[model samples]
Target: MTTTHATGTREEWLVARLKLLAVEKEFTRRGDELVQQRQALPWVRIDKAYRFDTEQGSVSLADLFRGRSQLLVYHFMFGPDYKAGCPSCSSIADGFDGIAVHLANHDVTLTAVSRAPLEKLLAYRQRMGWTFPWASSAGSDFNFDFNISFTEAQQRDGEVEYNYLRGRHAMDATPAPEPVVQFAANCGTDAQTYARDRPGMSAFVLEDGAVYHTYSTYARGVDGIWGMYQWLDRAPKGRNETGVWWKRHDEYARG
Candidate 1:
């Protein structure tokens, strides 16, 4: 598709650009306000002794901070039954590993958690060339507690809360969307198993030798962390699209 716009004089273009700049500045101010509010939110103390299987061996939730004051957990959607992580989550993660080092240097640790067992997570992480820490919550209630992984019975019942809301799911339909089916196939699983897991991110802070859940965001709330989308939002076309047009970075190489 082609888009045509009216040609404008240099003065006219400058005037239009100045108008847009004002709006952009206001938006940045509001974004800063939201960040302050998020930081002011109360931190809930975490008491459950959740365990994770990491390359460094079994570790607890507090251990994830790795001597840092803060921890950021990306709930990567790789369920126990899937052969790989979700493609969409993989796309988000493509922009994360590079920033993890910067965060680590700033007294924060960033890592990904999934239910796909340590072995599978390691294999896929190797394929993706991701250097950041990733761990498996397999055989633990971590993902279930965080509402990122669901059970078979829950799938049949078709009511699982995500992002703090409960709604009818694709599992309730006779046929789910083609993309859901395709994503399942790509992960070597069916739609039901694939949909059983959702993507999320959580923040934690260590204080007084105790771990506290500072905040969490799921679904669209996680979008701001996607560096590519942040760039696309500034592009001329601005995320112009009619359908899914991305794949795992490694998948592009194979193609």
Candidate 2:
């Protein structure tokens, strides 16, 4: 049950606080509604044989999940053509990598997938100083089937966003998803690179060592886990908007 305010101010101070309680209850109700909507999303099966390159060696979709019943794979935005990944995506993945071990204990194996070749993925991972499992899906239709790869025509139809050279929203990029595609609709693109409509996060359930795609998400659907600012925003040096930077505690360690 929600708490209520008292009728007293400074002279009757308790009453004002009581009113604030009512407002809190309304907020709780709205929050519950939002959660319900999120849980209502439908699931899909991944019949394609998506292969990835890992540090240990090459692996198939089923092999990646180990023995866990649930697998959550993040489709990182590092394409084979690009030397570097999207900065925003890099920022989000930074946190994801660190949390992998913790999540594994709970029967949820989390990993990152990208279209970059094995060497490229390893190079970037080293440069970014990440330890989470990363795999390459290059030379596979996995990206296209998942709606993240762009076709030349889709780029012309305003379906992809690229971040190559000087990023700009243009129709010049090659291989983009058509407007009819529900995944990449209204996606902003940068001319230097063509945006694929397949950018997304996917969840899977493994029973008897076989994996079944249970849920997947893209765009804002991943907003919850990608940013550290949300938690920091509640702190004293809080941010009121995006673009605020955070300094690591270790970086500020003083001898």
Per-candidate clashes, comma-separated: 0, 25
Q: Put down candidate 2 lDDT per residue, 90-179, tens digits, no spaces.
A: 667878766888889999899888887889878877877888888888877776666656665655566544332223243333442343
- In order, the Cα lDDT scores of the candidates are 0.88, 0.65
TM-score of structure candidate 2: 0.68
Position 130, candidate 1: lDDT: 88
What is the lDDT for 216 in model 2? 62
Clash tally for model 1: 0
Residue 182, candidate 1: C-alpha displacement in angstroms: 1.6
C-alpha RMSD of candidate 1: 1.9
What's the CA error at residue 167 for candidate 2, in Å?
A: 20
Give lDDT: candidate 2, residue 48: 77
C-alpha RMSD (angstroms) for model 2? 8.9
Stretches > 4 Å off in candidate 1 = 1-3, 170-174, 253-255
Residue 46: error of model 1 in Å?
0.7
